[model samples]
Target chain A: MEIDYSNIRVIGFDADDTLWVNETYFREAEEKVGMLLSHFETPNKIDQELFRMEIKNLPTYGYGIKGFVLSMVELSIELSNGTVSNKIISEILRIGKDMIDKPVQLLDGVEEVLISLSKDYKLILATKGDLLDQERKLEKSGLNQYFHHIEVLSEKQEANYQKLLNHLDINPTEFLMIGNSLKSDILPLINIGAKAIHVPFHTTWQHEKVERNATNGLNYKTVKSLREILNFFKQN
Target chain B: MEIDYSNIRVIGFDADDTLWVNETYFREAEEKVGMLLSHFETPNKIDQELFRMEIKNLPTYGYGIKGFVLSMVELSIELSNGTVSNKIISEILRIGKDMIDKPVQLLDGVEEVLISLSKDYKLILATKGDLLDQERKLEKSGLNQYFHHIEVLSEKQEANYQKLLNHLDINPTEFLMIGNSLKSDILPLINIGAKAIHVPFHTTWQHEKVERNATNGLNYKTVKSLREILNFFKQN
Candidate 1:
């Protein structure tokens, strides 16, 4: 479909993966975590167990590297039956720290797209993660200059999008969200009558991946890269 | 000191230890952590080391129990030189889990105070911590209805307060912040010329405690309890 965002006065961008490197780091960290626990379980089992732990710890740890670290600790003890070395635990913590400290490598042409969009649309960062971590990444990304508002939402369900748009005094018809996760960035906006474009990242976290049913009825466009998104804007 | 709050149009409440039980849990957990690590270091030394670790990890872990747990894990490995048993590590993880699961027990008269103040002044939750965790506590506290806006600041500094007030379209002269920590809640607001009331929580985090020099030149009220603050307001 030929998408038109001409009516949109506000454009919301997802911070992680879409604009900068995020999920890829999480993927690499999971590999390191698997290797750290290699003695207790197979690499595949460790990966499976880590996901379970992440889902279990969500209520307490919520989402982010902090939660991920905590889950790895929990899973290490479970997998090792309390035999995992303290040094290995420290290594896991280091993995999380390294992830948090990773440079905010923006996606290809992300800044150019944002720079172009900012002139015509009020841009906002709509993301969910550790508040300080997200702020640090945004600051490091040097892309904060392009955004009028920054939101670290807890989740991206339909109600959240509706509330966010309404809170900003934006009508659904005139709001557009460009992001990487269909679960987090695209489907929710489409469900709320707001326009959204899915700019798929190289790697998506398992939690954010959804089936076709979710996107079947959703009206949104998907672009290969952030650079392609500029073509959707009427101003450009 | 006799204080006047008649000029205050919006009253901000600090979350965590102020409205509900927070620091006390940390203290109890510290005691448990010390016992768990008693072989590695003296309880007194363990407590001191934990505080230092917390301060060190603030940049990565930020605040709240999740960071505290990570620091405890790091401290465990340090105290044991990587020989700390995985069972003890699991115990430390449990310490953190218990904290996050604790009920939001509002301080005596916190609800009544909020109820009374919400009638006349616009109430806002001004807090610093993990954003999602704070929101969860706020949701569990059942205090969401009282707030006109909720802010989970990354840090409580003069610049942050200035930015927050300006963004909310609030003037410093008309704003009042009531909380337990003088550093996080009182001084920052006072530095920006905002009215403030400090209702001391018994167990203050060492990081949140400041020397009397911090209070020397500052002009703000100190109340024995949250309930007493109602006397300062004309409504009650």
Candidate 2:
């Protein structure tokens, strides 16, 4: 897809895996959880069951590490028939705590790109998840100085992007969104008449993975990393 | 403290406990948690320990039912010396889940007050805590129609209030905040030169309770209930 950067004014960036290491930690947590529940079921079966539980509980739990931890705990009881040992349950919790404590490790060239872009465009952090967790990560990221505003959305969808654009008094054609997930970060913005650039994260969650249909008319560019975005704007 | 509503252009409300039942649920959940841990320690001791754990975990959990549940789970292990049974743990989880599923019971005259004030003045729902939970409650409460804007703040300090007012482009003197917490809803706005009205909730969370010192000169009003706020504007 051909992309133009001349009209773009406010640039929005997705925080999670797009900005720093996020889904990798979730995968690590799941691996640890599968091992902990190995006594009750095979690791492969546990992974499948956990994925099923997460999909079922998304409406109730929403997204983020807190919800992920709750699903793991609930799955333990269901798998063990309410007979899971306290030691294993505690271990599961320990895994969650460790994930939360993990530092916000920014990906390669994130800061330099943000710095270069902020001079020319208004940058806003638009990400979905638990409010407190996201706020904490943003603070710890020490990249708050670059962005003009931070919007922690409940979910990223077509209506959500439209609402944000309307609230910000932004023209969709003049706005650009960069993120990892096509289902969340790309398709919705494209549907709303905004331009989106997909910066694929190394580890994508199963839920976020989507099959692109040939019939869809969404126009977007998939870059290897954030550093490559600088190539799109000569001034940057 | 004397309050003059004559110049007010917008009236802001604190959602939890002020417009609806919130702190009461926390109290109820705490009681259930203390009971579940009674076998491990004295109920009084368990209550004290839980409070300690909650305060300690506030930085990590922030303020929400999800954080409260995680604290309960953590405290259970400490109180029972890791001997807490899965049955009791599951019970604790159920207590938290029930709190989330509970109905949004708006306090007396909340809707009427909103409807009345919204006509004469722009009404805004300015509350703090979990963003998703707050959004859900607002949707379920049928109160969203009356609010010009609903802000779910992470914290309600003077700076946050200032930023909100600036975002809405309202003068401090032309705004009035009515809510149940002196620390969160009232004092901060007063400090920022905004008019405030304190409507005390029947149950105040310990974290929100603050001693009123007679030193500060900021003026505000304390209404008995939401219904009385209508009386502030004589034309209503």
Candidate 3:
């Protein structure tokens, strides 16, 4: 699918997976917890049990250290036959806390692509995560300078996308949503009559990935990587 | 600050941290990647290197896995002096893939609060994230049942909140934004004369935490948990 970048005045980008290393860190931590859980229960069971607790706690606690800490505590308690040790809880907390303090990494060709795109498109950083963590990552990553606007949101609902379009004073048809998650990035944009480019990342967070129906080809297109975006513009 | 739940004709929620365990997983994954980098250089040096890469990549990649995978590969190459092994790359990929598979965990009291609130207010799930991920999480977490309208968005700018109020056919003052992030959930709502109850989460993602001042006292109030919302409504 070809896109006319000239017509696209504002281009919005998803921050966590699109711009830098995000899910890998979470994956590694889950694996660590999974490994520990294996000592008591099967991996599948451990995941199921932990997931139940996570879902139950999400409304009140939310993502990040608080959520992770709660999950670990619950998992430890469950695995230890309701006898969670302080040592185990402490270790998990330490590991969880240590996770966010890690370094931010950029994807391949990100700079080249952003630089190339920014020359024409009004670049915006649209990401959904904890407010402070996302900003720190951006500041630390040094990517904060390139964006004309930075939006750190809670979830990527249609209203949020529409709000972004409204704030930019651009028509939905004139905006393009670019990111990896079909659930958060592409679908909402498509629903709102905006153009969307789905650059599929190899690893999607379990909750983020969606089953796609290739039959409906309307406002959305999926590309393999960021480099494909340039070609999309050139072709259109 | 107190609020009257009985007067709340409509209630909206912020997803991600508000509804589930999101950041901790990302944080954990980041820590692991950082540790891996430390094997090649000092923690601080690795952090600086990764930060530079992340900043450079934001415009090209938006958020989630694509950015993360690219960052990991870049980090591996940099740390390995451009001779990063396939094994290490595979390791990174493995970690990234694991994150996508982790189940969606909702926060504690989410169901209870939503169930109670849904009884009185026109419940809407106003969240921002990757569309597919948020939807799947809602479906799997079994919380989608409570919400009459579910909006997945890219960002929660003021316009989006206003649009939501318009869509719901409710006065801005009649709407309530309940969630963890003060930046996205509270500030935007407050900007438009809507009431917001901030349920502070321990680990706020970098991007979602915005700087608030004394001037932000008009339409916003911070609470410790979701359960306290009932009391807020009664007092007001």
Instruction: Give me the candidate number with maximum DockQ.
Output: 1
Model 2 Cα shift for residue B221 (angstroms): 1.0
Worst 10 residues of 1 chain B by lDDT: B227-236
Residue-wise lDDT of candidate 1 within B115-176, one digit each (tens)? Answer: 88898889999999888778889989999999987888999999989988876787899899
Error of 3 at A153 (Å): 1.2
Chain A TM per prediction: 0.96, 0.96, 0.91
lDDT of 3 by residue, A130-173 (tens): 54567668878887667876776556889878867775789988
Error of 3 at B118 (Å): 29
Writing each residue's lDDT as its tens digit, candidate 2 over A9-36 gives 9999999999999998999899988888
Q: Candidate 2: where is the Cα deviation over 4 Å?
A: B214-216
Candidate 3, residue A31: lDDT? 75
Predicted structure 1: lDDT: 0.87
Greater lDDT among 1 and 3 belongs to 1
User: What does the lDDT read for residue B67 in candidate 2?
Assistant: 79
Please give, as one word, the docking class of candidate 3.
incorrect
State which candidate, 1 or 2, has the greater lDDT.
1
- Candidate no. 1 TM-score: 0.96
Query: Interface RMSD of every candidate?
Result: 1.0, 1.4, 16.1
DockQ of 3: 0.03
Q: What is the lDDT of residue A120 in candidate 1?
A: 82
Which one wins by lDDT: 2 or 3? 2
Whole-model Cα lDDT of every candidate shown, in order: 0.87, 0.87, 0.71
